[model samples]
Target: MPRPSEARPSGARPSAQVRRFTPAERWVHRATAALMGVCLVTAGCLYLPPLAELVGRRRLVVTVHEWAGLALPVPVLLGLASRAFRADLRVLNRFGPHDGVWLRSALRRRGPRPAGKFNAGQKLWAAWLTGAVLVMLGTGLLMWFTRLAPLLWRTGATFVHDWLALALGVVLAGHIGKALGDPEARRGMRTGFVGRWWADSAHPLWRPGD
Candidate 1:
């Protein structure tokens, strides 16, 4: 009988199964958002002729433009498909009267933050972003599948799409700039676990126990 052929193992090792991203899922999250960012920036550029050169090639930009729109919203949808995302969203989403107090204090130039898992500003940002995402996705589908809409609906969709694009462009710039300003803040989302102290300090109310 021929000697058993020396071969690689049939089963993957336990170490091989362990993953940070269950198949690059974190990277996928980053990639989809990055593509969406490109689409938004390019479209915003086309809003003014002076910015067009940076975007370049109208037809090519348009091609990239639509594809990116189609690509984003997918990951979020997939995230929503998960029970954990829903649970986490619920926790991240709850708003409280203390949040208002926090907001008022900040507005009054008081550096003191009302302790919680999230401050008023963070809650407002989260709430506003959720609405923006819904509006963007809904209007995007209208523009993406134009044939489904009558002339009036299509026209309305176009206007809303353009306006939202402009508005969200500016808002997201602030969002990204803030992220870049803080190293720990940026890492929290990537790791999905903020340092316990970071969490406590940043969101006093949301501290693990209280």
Candidate 2:
């Protein structure tokens, strides 16, 4: 019988898997997603007359929405304790020369996609979502505790809070659609490991050891 190493074809590369999301990172992602889902569902119930009538618990919905939105930052805050999560956050925050090219290509719908661990679009989406959530929380607090601000401030908060919530729904839908379209990317998130081949092709700039 041939030795295991000798059995491979000449010049063939071994199939390897790379770590993608750490357990800490995945847990944070899932926890945040669950809370956001609760917030969105409860917001729909509170805002949509049809849903409000069907649900028939206006006060309960309001309570749930408020609590869920308030808890949105908890997972991200906890995630900062993990070294891997912190490293990924740094990667997401920094935009290199290639990122501009990636954004332009993305907008033009031509040329090669980004080869970074997180693409430009993903970075922008993450940043936008973070800001939107913080703004929503601030506005929500103003609306919840009327004494926090004057009537004019409270009114403006309500307007911003409501419209921003609508915008979040749309952006989140697009995010989900993109995720659903990428099986390998989804697999990485689901299993925490991805093929080296995928890493090379989709994220050539990403090094597993990095």
Best-fitting candidate, scored by TM-score: 2
* Reference-based TM-score, model 1: 0.72
Look at candidate 2 and tell me the lDDT of residue 182.
Answer: 70
Question: Residue 201 error for model 2, in Å?
Answer: 1.4
* lDDT, model 1, position 205: 60
Against the reference, the lDDT scores of all candidates come to: 0.64, 0.87
* Candidate 2 per-residue C-alpha lDDT over 33-141 given as tens digits, one digit per residue, 9 for 90 to 100: 9999999999999888999999987998889898999999999999999999999999999999888988898799778775589878889999999999999999999
Assess every candidate by TM-score. 0.72, 0.92
Please report how far candidate 1 places residue 55 from its true position, in Å.
4.8
The best candidate by lDDT is: 2
Once model 2 is optimally superposed onto the true structure by TM-score, how far is the C-alpha of residue 21 displaced, in angstroms?
0.6
Tell me, what's the RMSD of every candidate? Answer: 13.3, 6.4
